[model samples]
Target: MAEKPGLVKTRQERVETRLRQRQVYNERMSKKRRARPRSLNIGDVVLMKNRRPGSKFKTRFESGMWAVTRVKGTLVTVTKGDEVVTRNISCFKRYHGAPADHQESGNNSDHEEGECEFGRVGGTAEHWLASGNLQMGEGLAAQKTTTPGSPVPNQDDVPAEAPAEGSNSEATRRSGLGRYNLRSRLTLPERLRDYVCE
Candidate 1:
């Protein structure tokens, strides 16, 4: 009966030691881990992670935006149009803009009038090029000519000049093969230069 008290004391000591070790391990791991965002709420917009197989250039999140309908602890329920999905908060990234409903209704006055859903003030890249607002190899030139407060000039107003004769810039821009061609002109090693074909 006297040995029972000693055994209980030893077991208590071991349990206390293990608890201390566990606490230390948890503190170390918490420092390396990223804190989850706790500001998520209903009506907030967020983008869900995309798991589809794609090239390296593909976006990490889906293009379609989802609005948070319900937030239950770590799980968030989102809806995009007719589609509804419930996923963990870790799978979502908070979107920083007005909700789609406000944007569609034109109730958001922060955006310019007639701004496209994609946020382009004007039309597409082709439209900009056709309007002579943009040109090949002259994007920087246009920016340079305009002062900080001055408006950009139309490319149509200024005549286009032909590139200098024998200039490799145009060739390099048209085909990447020109850059590789320069490697062939490098002098061969001394040992390889002495060998001549019959």
Candidate 2:
């Protein structure tokens, strides 16, 4: 009768140990497994995987492009002209073709057609430019004014002449290592001593 309680206790301990081991195993596997890419949307261009047996020279995906018409769970419906086909999401790879508007306009709407003459000033300008929320000039202008504690200087206050050698101007300081200067100009012997040669 006493053995019954001992057996029950040991059985419960074994089950708990199994649960803990399984939890740890699952955590380890989850780390190794890659997260799936973003789901395909309607109107997305995709290439269907070629399942036919072929030589090494044959391409993995078919040459023709297919436009995603519908996405229902794991299944995706794609059409190329009159021919329509339904296949698993894994069988189709997203195709990033040139935008229809870009083709028609002959210019990319995302990027303005102008040289960015000024250097990027701050994080606000970088963020705005990256997000496409502001144009290059507009972002730079915003950066100049929006920066706290820094007073916006008028056109009259700007210096006409470039800073002389040894001057500690803001532009001089920011230019740093990239700007060619007499100090950075080193002899072959000095270069060998300073830098590690392959």
The TM-score, computed over Cα atoms with residue i paired to residue i, of candidate 2 is 0.37
Q: Candidate 2's error at 110, in angstroms?
A: 18
Model 2, position 161: C-alpha lDDT score: 86
Candidate 1 worst ten-residue window by lDDT: 127-136
| Over 4 Å off, model 1 | 1-32, 98-184, 191-198
Worst 10 residues of 2 by lDDT: 116-125
TM-score of each: 0.45, 0.37
**Which regions of candidate 2 deviate over 4 angstroms?**
1-37, 99-198
With candidate 2 superimposed using the best TM-score fit, by how many Å does residue 147's alpha carbon deviate from the native? 37
Best by lDDT: 1
Q: Tens digits of per-residue lDDT for model 1 on 117-154?
A: 32233423232222332212343344456543345667
Candidate 1's clash total is: 0
